[model samples]
Target: MNRLLLYVHFNKEDSLSTHVIFQLQALRTIYSKIILISNSHLDRVSLDKLPYDIFLQRNNKGFDFAAWADGMRMVGFDELKEFDSVTIMNDTTFGPIFDFASVVDRMDSSESDFWGITNNRAHSADIGGQLRPLKEHIQSYFITFQQRVVAHLSFQYFWENVQSYDDVNQVILNYETAVTNYFIQEGFKYGVQFDTVSEDISNMQNSDFSIFGVKKLLEYRIPFVKIKAFIHNAEKPEINTIFDEIVSSSDYPSHLIVDHMTFADYPDRDYLLSQKTLDFSSLKGSRTRVGIHLHISCEDEIESFLSSFDQYLDNYDLYLTTSLEEVVASFDKKVKEVILVDRGINAILAWQKIQDRLVGYQIAGHFEESSFSDAIDSLLKPAKKIVAYATINEKIGLVVSDLTVSTRTEPIDEDSMWPYMAQLWNMIYPHNEKNLKKQDIYVRSATASFWYRPKALEKILSIDLNALVIQDLSAMATITHSFSNLLTYVAWANGFDFRFSQPHLLTGFEVRRRFESRPFLMVEEPAILQLKSSKAKRIIGYTIKRLKTIVKKLKY
Candidate 1:
């Protein structure tokens, strides 16, 4: 009896993705018979050069199911039943990402007759056996079948009845969801790498080894991770920091990941080449694919801000006080797009001019010339209608969960000119019963720059900017600060909500339940946390000196 692995690989670009190539190296470890089933329209000459057995098929648009079924057809049922165990896998993920062989080795000895790498309760269909079970549906990315289960009459018929569909939902309903339900009805008990379905998601039990759990990152406990999860806040520093730490401790090449990302462009010349020539032209992967357009109100220190981002992309549609213009020749692989407001008018007006232009983009943000590269990453990670600020401050309240805490980073008094501005702010948002608290509404920073979907600001932008006049103030707080401070409120007034960029640094919700007197740590960027957590104290001495007061006040 032997073990076999059938890998289903496809891409719309007519070539295998770099992520697939990385998975192949690990596949060789556990499978006695390794086969690749490709539906991508790749060059035959290049495909013929691959080391493993290959089955090229027509692109039926059924997702992974079509590839797997066609590949199994190549390996007749007689041959499939001969193997002691079988695993059906696909290129939809980026692992046995960490020692996948070990995961297979453990499952080889598992008590259950069949099992999947993990299970998820999400995306329930609720139609009884027709849909996935309420408790769990063994995830289909990589599932193993013992010989006893493989030889079952039902197993063969499952594939015989399997269908392919152009509609994505129909495909999932037919294959991914159908397989798990079929298995459970056949009286087979299943297990998962991470049992988070029963455990609390916040705590790292067994280091939380599911494919997508952020906690499992500490141990690389789970072998495969769905590559698409990296798009949002799923790429948390707290999670990836553990993975990077593991990589740093090992002899493995970090460039493998760096290179895999570069080759992710798909349809590259070296798609099937065993030996890839790294692009020496750029020391790092290009940031062209990872991007967000920055709309800066005409502010000084623009050069300083440009230097802080990963790439200095000058691509923008500039809007002047009188008209709009595009900055040409600024477009390159490094930039997605850039928009500039030439007139040194107020920030809100600049945001208004570009509101319509930003309709199509899913993620975009507003920035003062005051953000760092790391802050940009944090801002872009959350789901839609998200208002992620650069950092959290405690000037508002002791509890982190309390959203109505004071945002006053500075003081205002009866005689202060800001007090008069507060009166004006009250006049604008005034409803005698639900009056906007002048203090809690203002953010910790005097500046109001945030990242959110462009459409969220449509209601606020509709207000006539021309009717408003900025009166010069003798006080330190001016009209600019008052207008900028309304950002959070504007978001709340709309249907959006926000989370602080670094909740781990402050009193976590669990900790906030207790009345501890630790001063709130008000950090402005993710880079500051890196510096604060640095083992090399001397490296961040200057930054440390400036932050001591902020950190000390919180602890005392």
Candidate 2:
């Protein structure tokens, strides 16, 4: 017969109180003698309800449970000396199923002093003297011992040497380690039951254990306990119930219906509004008069994007048509005048108001009301060209007759402005024919456009415009030839003595021609240009020297 002694040390907060009771009840039917030792009064009362014998620790102030249990084990071992073996189980351990009796019988028959049920074990080098490499450290302190050793040696002898709880734990660990090493050294065949019928019983309280493992343990009819000491600190049930309700309600589809005309993807709204405000602010005016009829069905995009712009372009006057609060707030203290048009209002009535008040170019994208006809009509009334940037495909049939339409495409080169020019040419003539001679539209390189604009403001704006122009031309020869003609025309008109040729001279004539042409469309003073030129030369020389040094190092 194998008598099992179960011991557990826990506080009020241990999570395994209830789990231990169920395990004890299940084990009582299987094991001949089941003894439980615990420090908790609640646990004792719970155990008393069951058929198993319970030993309650009276003095709970110190870590004396190990000593108390060890003494009890000695007494029990002496009484059960005739018994084949003694099994010690922690409260957290569950089990002793399938052929556990056979295993004990085998261990009793063997000459080896100790038999470990679990394959998992650990040995510390410093404490164990000679260490036995273990597959894994046993999770809970549980062991089966031969009754003769327990009766003769006594657990009291082991406990007497242990001064503290830490010492007791270390002794237990070292004992197992020494036993494993000693068995290997003595050439003794000690049995290790790899296939055990029991599991760590307090796993219900151990949330870290896999659910699959718990299910497996339960399936094998193994007795187990679940301890939950954290239940006292649980949040009020009402609060949890209310929170769950709110989460479920929010996830309900009926609660989240969005109007196709009103809803905009958050990012799209943000991007559009950012681009709109940035484009408006970049216009050359302190009190920039801007008319934006955001008639597109992207209310969310319009709302967020415009909200971001409201922070910066406060000085500019804006006319907007939207019911969104952010659009309304954007008018606060920033714009000279704000006209908020209700989205629900009549479209024709809104268009009339927009057309009458919008004197300059109207800023819009893909609007039915603000069409090419409307833009051309506005341009005919002495307004500057409708400077609108549109997507390459979207710009088709959007003929802004007199207005210069700035169309943009995805970037294709290091030069950021090329794509814009490429798309613009595509918009002007929606054909993909590559006949250089037959094409009426002439393309110039950004480098060449830089040399065309002369005036300061014209030069500054032309830098971007010229870059866009040159971006359309794929070949350098076409750009270079076209730039020469454009520069010659400008020189003749401006009364400057300048001409450009192949293998160009960087003399006074070339310099004069470059300045007159405003290559790169820069409008800096003569002194600034001279300084920049000298600095550029120095940078080039430095870069060349560094490249040579790197080459030399690479060669070595």
Candidate 3:
């Protein structure tokens, strides 16, 4: 069949990810034509000669629904019936775990007009009053429509009539849930390639067992597996071992999955990588330009900082904001651009000046010398602003203990000079009082080290930092002279909220103090995980229960 595939893609970093590339490559064989609808704020020139037609857009309203609507409009009414079939796909899932062509061919031969690989009832309490899942709809990650269904008036109406929504629940109710029902109610049959519903495949009480069902999806020719599946079982003990086996067996690239989890939710990654099951050598993501801004005020800390930085200095441009020629000469080849600001220039000026020089980069980060070097990636995450956990120094006294790894937000002194300073902060041109109020307005920590998106900090950049207060804050002329403590608030006040970086576990210089093992009973490998089937496990557990009951009865 001559099929047209419309893909909705959103890369928070505005670069094509390895998984998306893999998905597109797989689709090339299945579809006659492909078009990508992206909400990435990227230039067409930078995208180069990506094989498919691309529509780069700015409106990020309805998530996948918005992108789908935009793609349909771009395809236009005349092009609607040009293909034998149409498929709506997105990058939320991680694979074409197996080849997609066989699945497409199978679906094409079937009488079903609209179908997806798997269908699931949401686990949101059913009419029975028991915890039964309801609403079996084809998961929207990959949905295909035969020409008969695609040509229907309802299909066109669904796209054209899509509405904007602030809350995601509205998007699901209208775009995903309601759209599927509309087609089914209008004399159209909907089907799923996998006969098993979500609840049926694995009991709701133990959804982690759904991993086995997903394995069938791989063997039964299901192309895509949702990435969120792993997230749901991230805390499960065997999740790492199971996923490693799955990735290796499926022939899906390992780095794509691991790299995504690292940023998507690094805590999950810590477990997955602790065992080092996945190979990360082939994990080169799409070419992205990220500039970093760093200050060099302390002579003692520079050497220590560079030593830590040299560990992951991979091809990234380092921007230093220091006027000291001695400090610049002290630096090696790693320093790319040194924007010379006077030694007395406050932290705000250094950042502002550096940002002016970092135009066109997708991600820009700022770090203090003491901030862990590994915090670079954590900082560059596609949030409005991201701050490293200031574990020691600066806010060290406020943290209360040396063992504390995260920076905490505390209430500022209301009656003191801070209220006047806050007044001045709100008066900063282009400020957003509404967004600032949404966050902790009187946050006292986390101004020492952080990363922020330059676009989100535009208001901060536009202002002359030196003029914000009377003179450079380094002089500490007044009690409010410590404006550097409020930089986190500046980012927030400018409508750019910040998220905390994963707490760095250990220091570069410190050895992990080893201690004697605590008193505990030793167990064999069964405690980690059992390789037995559910039936076998249940039988063992039931036998144990019966034996205990008999022992109690005899004692009585």
Candidate 4:
């Protein structure tokens, strides 16, 4: 078949990723002609590497639909009719996990006017704070149009009228969802490569098949896997199973997925840790050298902290930083060295003092004395597992205490620190404007305690302390909260994954289970989520409000 492929792509970095390159290389086998339309800047070097017949680099105003429209126009309506098939796709997925040629050959025999890889069921969308009903449509990520459909006047009219929208929901409501239905309403038959109706209905209704049934799709030999399956459906433990299946079932490079996960803009900090969590019990007997930087701003928790370190000190080197002279004699293990600094300097600056010593270990951990107020023992609870995981995987640049995962309900006060952190981020990554959306993606532990590689800290450590500007914070705590967020950002930005570690016994799930098993667990839930999820509660709440109104009326 003479197939024309229109591939739309965009990224914050404005460069081609290895996975995208891999997809294009595979696609070249099935596509007779391929046009690469990018809504972002791509330098000559990047343009030269793509396996495309033509490349269109345009300003990133609209999303994928606008790019596809431009691509169709560039091909010209007359030229599109010549091809047996035309496929419109985007870079939001990682594949061909299955053979593309087989998929194309199978779909070629079908008599449908147009088809897509998957069908999105009817669902409600919140557009401008108003819930709007969206009709079921063929997913926009991968849709192939037969020549008959492409030659239709309605198809040409649809492409010609396609334009940019200020809101993506507007684009989806008008274009992505409308395109499939538009063709069907014009008396053109449409089909999907994998029909969900014949298979499980539960996975299809009110949920995305690309996300919820991705593993099943791959098992059914669907060519591509959506990236959102890993990020969005992280609560499901089966995501890891999908990753393992991809490695065992296909010749696709697994490292490319890992690379994307490490560097991509994650949905939030919770997904980051959940997707990249390492099994603590499985990793044992690691020979990697580990160093601990214990910064003691206060001596109150010194005894408890050192007591917990007794088991770990035999295998790890321990360095102490404190202002008090008497606190030096409190360790059971031989202290490698002691550095004396003023009490209020904090972990950020104190680590700056020990940069020379940082290079000696494969795994370096930073623990603040102030961070461990009464919970000092819990700080080092997962130290061994953390070091073991870091040793086994070179990609892990940082592993922080799992406090962020546990206390996620309580938000960080980034408002006060925003002015300083924003300036710091811009200074570090001036070219990447996505850095300005700091609070949205900020993932940091309240306690600045984390295990990291020496190289991950190089970017932040390179900047002098005098460069940061802050207001209304103690002279000592100026960089504490902001620097915590920046620390994780720099780690992931430099092609290193950050993980969260908690004691095996005290997992977030276990803690939640302990609370939930109690009678009063509903009190812990947010009122809005509680009322929405429970019909009985909503009725009871209504009854109470009605009774209160009656009582007030009677009293009057």
Q: Pick the candidate with the highest TM-score.
A: 4
- TM-score to true structure, per model: 0.46, 0.30, 0.50, 0.60
RMSD of each: 15.2, 29.3, 14.3, 11.4
Worst 10 residues of 3 by lDDT: 392-401
Clashing pairs in 3: none
Candidate 4 similarity to native, TM-score: 0.60
**Which segments of candidate 2 are over 4 A away from where they belong?**
2-6, 9-11, 14-16, 58-77, 94-112, 121-140, 151-156, 166-189, 195-556
lDDT over C-alpha atoms for residue 472 of model 1: 44
lDDT of 4 by residue, 1-556 (tens): 8999999989877867878888998999999999999998888888777899999988887799889999989989999999999999999999998777877887777888899898877778777788988777888999999999888899899999998876888897899888988998999888888876445657442457787788778878788889887777654546656776786688888767766765675423332333444546676645456788888766687666766676554476778887777666654345777788766566777776776687678888787776654224334655666777787777778876544213323323445677778767777778873454544335565356778887877777667653342343354354655766787777766767777554433444554564476532223445434343333343343333323323333443
| The best candidate in terms of lDDT | 4
* Candidate 3 residue-wise lDDT, 87-128, digit = tens: 888878887777778878988888888887776554453223
Candidate 4, residue 6: the lDDT equals 98
lDDT string, candidate 2, 327-410, tens digits = 457544543344566544332234334543443422221123223233322221211112222211121111122111121111
Off by over 4 Å in 1: 45-49, 122-135, 202-212, 217-220, 234-246, 249-253, 259-556
Q: What is the lDDT of candidate 2?
A: 0.35
Candidate 3 regions with alpha-carbon error over 4 angstroms: 54-56, 122-134, 198-202, 205-221, 267-271, 274-556
Q: Arrange candidates, best TM-score first.
A: 4, 3, 1, 2
User: Between prediction 1 and prediction 2, which has the larger lDDT?
Assistant: 1
Residue 166 in model 1: lDDT:
72
